[model samples]
Target chain A: MPFVTFLDYAGVAVFAATGALAASRKELDIIGFLFLASVTGIGGGTFRDLILGIPVFWVINRDYVWICASVAVLVFLTAHRFESRYKLLLWLDAVGISAFSVMGAAKGLVVTGSVSVAIITGMLTATFGGILRDLLAGEPSVLLRPEIYVTATLIGAAVYTGADIAGLAPLLASILGFVAAFIVRGGALRFGWTFPAYKGRPGRHPDDIP
Target chain B: MPFVTFLDYAGVAVFAATGALAASRKELDIIGFLFLASVTGIGGGTFRDLILGIPVFWVINRDYVWICASVAVLVFLTAHRFESRYKLLLWLDAVGISAFSVMGAAKGLVVTGSVSVAIITGMLTATFGGILRDLLAGEPSVLLRPEIYVTATLIGAAVYTGADIAGLAPLLASILGFVAAFIVRGGALRFGWTFPAYKGRPGRHPDDIP
Candidate 1:
């Protein structure tokens, strides 16, 4: 439990830094940096908790907020040192999503005892915060892209939940899930791997059909 | 409770219709319409519930899902009859936001006994679904516009919670809250009222400072 918890904090810190970087790019104030960081850090877990009808994790534990705030402040102070802010955001986001998806799946399984819900929770945990961050920045969301972001989370979550269900220890299952998600996402980041866009002829517009 | 419940249902129905309309504009399938409708109908309340660490209203009661689905189906079948899709969306959204805001403030007050939290809950309930709906449809959110949307919700929520804190009966406070929100929002819709955008020089860019 301690090991997984450590990973969760690490992931949240990285996620918070990415959010703060985004805020800096937008020329937002320190308050904006903190807001974006906190939301990006906990938004996915919050969504998972809400959908699964459990207590929100952050409200139950204030440590997450503190960690996010600290990370945001650090990012705010050190942003100018980054050589390539975009690359940092991408890599950090990849690692954060990898860890968060596994954690989300583990919690979902514990709470709901349903594989499908766990998988959905994992995907949401990985992607929803980034989606919200993009929305806040008025940028196109990763969900709208051809990149295999959500797919990576799905694969990792499925692997972790399946391994746990098959009697592997929780820590080992988490590690396996994290590694799998990180590999796929990291590969995509490095190689521009993506899902193929729809190639078929467009359907008649709904207005035309009506 | 009955009156509040009725208002909740009405707000959900209107919100669902707006979501279905967004799906239609995207040329999404029936499943898309259902997904968008359900999310838009319950998303805001869900946010409020999560923030307040309370049970989500829809999870506790399944009727909300049914109502959203029914509204989506109706919208899907009858969308072509509307004289102007955008106008219908705007008017329905206005009504939905007004009702949802008041309901959110009332519930927040009941649950937390904090006027500030209640006001925040109200604003979130009024605006979050629309924000998410725009995100799903890949459009600029209403929050980014210089319209009087969130302002109206804030005004209404503040009035409701303030009135409640002033010892008004719950029902009377709610009526006053609802009427106050609806009138402000409706006036904005009718007269194009908007908050003035920032007219002063922008602050120094963060990068420009030492």
Candidate 2:
């Protein structure tokens, strides 16, 4: 449970950082940056919680709320020095994704007693927050990008599923899943890996072709 | 019932037009444009219905889905000439907002026995489609704008509530609500009326105060 709390905090912070960094780039004032960041950080998990008929985490736990907001403020204040080296932000985002995905999966399993649903929840927890942040920031969401974003989460879910099936301890399984996702995402960024796209080349428009 | 159905379709078409016009400005292809328009047209109703534990309108009727998509396609085929003209897009958006606000209130009242809840539902139904579209298209959502956007929907919801209490038929109540929202939003746009920021002057952070 303590470990789970750690992951939750880490996830919340990373999500906030992504939003804060993006907002800062837009020249938004500190209040605007924090507002955007807090929303982005908690957005995905809150969405999952809402759909699952649970109290929103930040609302129920003031710690989560304050942490998210504080992280955003900290990031904004320190961003000027960190801006030249942006890799730190990306790494933080990855760690956040991994942590949230693991926590989400575990929570889903605990709440629903269904592994499949839990896995889906884990994936959603990892992705939806960033998707919302990206959308609000007017960036093309990763869903449309040739990025392996969802794939990383899917693989993480699968790892978690496998651990569950093998009767591995839940905490261990979560850790394993998190590591898997983190590595996949980090390796992709480092090696310039990308998913394939249908680049609007002269493809046969079967719908248009009578 | 038949009249209600007519209004719903008209609302969806109008919202779809607004989405298509906005997405076209971003040079999104038909798929992206349609996706945006569909969300703009139905996102609020779907969310409202889902929260109310009722089946989403499009999922239950399918007619709603077809109307949104087909309108989007039709609009896309003619977008080049229209998207550049901001006034045209604004006009379409206003129509969509008005119709959606009315229908939202009408349906909410029909489904829920509480007038206050109905008002909230109406406001959500009128506003969320645009909130969603803005999120998707990476524009600042109208909800966040310093304008009387959502206030108009709230007033319209109130009028709808009054009409319902006054023994007006559902269709008449819906029409009156739509006209109220249309006139308010149209007047705001025409006169460039906007809400002033609530910020107190510089060097005075309310949060920072001892």
Give all TM-scores, in the order shown.
Answer: 0.59, 0.56
RMSD of each: 7.6, 9.0
Candidate 1: Cα lDDT at B132: 84
lDDT (10s digit) by residue, model 1, range B110-201: 87676755776788798889888998888667654544666678777888888888998777777787888888878878887664432222
Off by over 4 Å in 1: A195-210, B1-46, B50-210
DockQ measured for candidate 2? 0.06
Candidate 2: the clashing residue pairs are: A138-B138
Worst 10 residues of 1 chain A by lDDT: A26-35
* CA lDDT of each prediction against the hidden true structure: 0.81, 0.73
List model 1 lDDT by residue over A43-123, tens digit each.
888888888878667656667878888987787777767766666877899999999889889889999999998998999
Span of 10 residues, lowest total lDDT, candidate 2 chain A: A82-91
- For candidate 1, the docking band is incorrect
Q: Who wins the TM-score comparison?
A: 1
lDDT of 1 at B18: 93
